[model samples]
Target: MTSPEVDFTRRNPTARPLTDKERDALDEFVDSIHYSSRYNDDHYEYRHVQLPKQMLKKIPKEYFEPSRGTLKLLWEEEWRGLGITQSLGWEHYEVHEPEPHILLFKRPMNYQPPAQH
Candidate 1:
């Protein structure tokens, strides 16, 4: 008989909390994957993340349909805090998915963030 597939998103039942050193290492790794500038310019810093087919399959079917608005909504959700302005923010940003399951995000590197409310 075949064993059930593992769901990676769920933490293992016997997992232990990260030690201080491990936490620091994880933080450094996260920083390394954050926004990176493609070109030396005042305009933008870019970053991207690729979703594997398994993860993409978990999303709703409508999100993958051929609609510009639906596509933008997906981008918006992925880019909520990166830098896009909605009602009260100074910085502007953009998102693109040039390839299936690949999301590219860019935001101005020179602009100051909006004041806290």
Candidate 2:
């Protein structure tokens, strides 16, 4: 979805073009848009690791999935710096603690982002 500034530029090519900042803003906005429709049926490489009980202490409190008895870390706060995490989405993946000290990271196996023209 585009902002009003983008829409304005699109509707009026003859009008004033987007400023450098506006163009950068539009690029950032466009990058942030998740095209779910294009990736609704993505294939993921499911993998898990057994973490030492001590490592559990580092997990953020908000990530605990109490109902499932798991922790879901979809962003890059805790484990993104690791090589394994980088192979995963780096900024994506999940951590499920089906059992104590165990984590399952589900990442897209071969995700290809849509080409930008």
Candidate 3:
């Protein structure tokens, strides 16, 4: 939630798949909600089908949309990607993108650092 990332620890692989526990977390966000879960041999991803009031709520008080890109910025700072060297590839990050709304939680699992900055 903090990072917008689906944490990809080995046991969970595609990172933390939403379980009953995560679903429970969404209660705070749910006025109504729906989703679809998908999986490959290795990873899993669940797309948000519907957003209830709780999830639509603003950061502190009222209801609004959740900006995943904004969340990802906070998350990268928290994760310290800023401290890592920048590469043309996945090992480095944009730190911030031109479109904050577009960059969600994405950790390139197959990232290979490019030769130049």
Best by lDDT: 2
Superposed model 2: Cα runs more than 4 Å off: 1-42, 66-69, 81-84, 88-97, 112-117
Candidate 1 C-alpha error for residue 56, in Å: 1.0
**Residue-by-residue lDDT tens digits, candidate 3, 1-117:** 322333322111122223455345544544333333422223222222333333422322111114432322223222222121222322112222343322222334344556566
Q: Is candidate 1 or candidate 3 better by TM-score?
A: 1
TM-score of candidate 1 on Cα atoms, chains taken together = 0.41
Best by TM-score: 1
The 10-residue segment of model 2 with minimum total lDDT is 3-12
C-alpha lDDT of candidate 2 relative to the true structure: 0.39
Better of 2 and 3 by lDDT: 2
Q: lDDT per prediction? A: 0.37, 0.39, 0.29
Please identify model 1 stretches exceeding 4 Å from their true place.
Answer: 1-42, 67-75, 78-98
Model 1: lowest-lDDT 10 consecutive positions: 83-92
Order of models, best lDDT first:
2, 1, 3
Which of candidates 2 and 3 is the stronger one according to TM-score? 2
Name every residue pair that clashes in candidate 3: 7-15, 8-15, 29-54, 29-55, 31-52, 31-53, 32-52, 56-64, 57-63
Deviation (Å) of 20 in candidate 2: 35
Q: How far in Å is the alpha carbon of 74 misplaced in model 1? A: 2.6
lDDT of 2 by residue, 1-117 (tens): 211111221121222233455344334223222212112224554445555554445444444546655554433433332212234252323343345555444445575656769
TM-scores for all candidates? Answer: 0.41, 0.39, 0.23
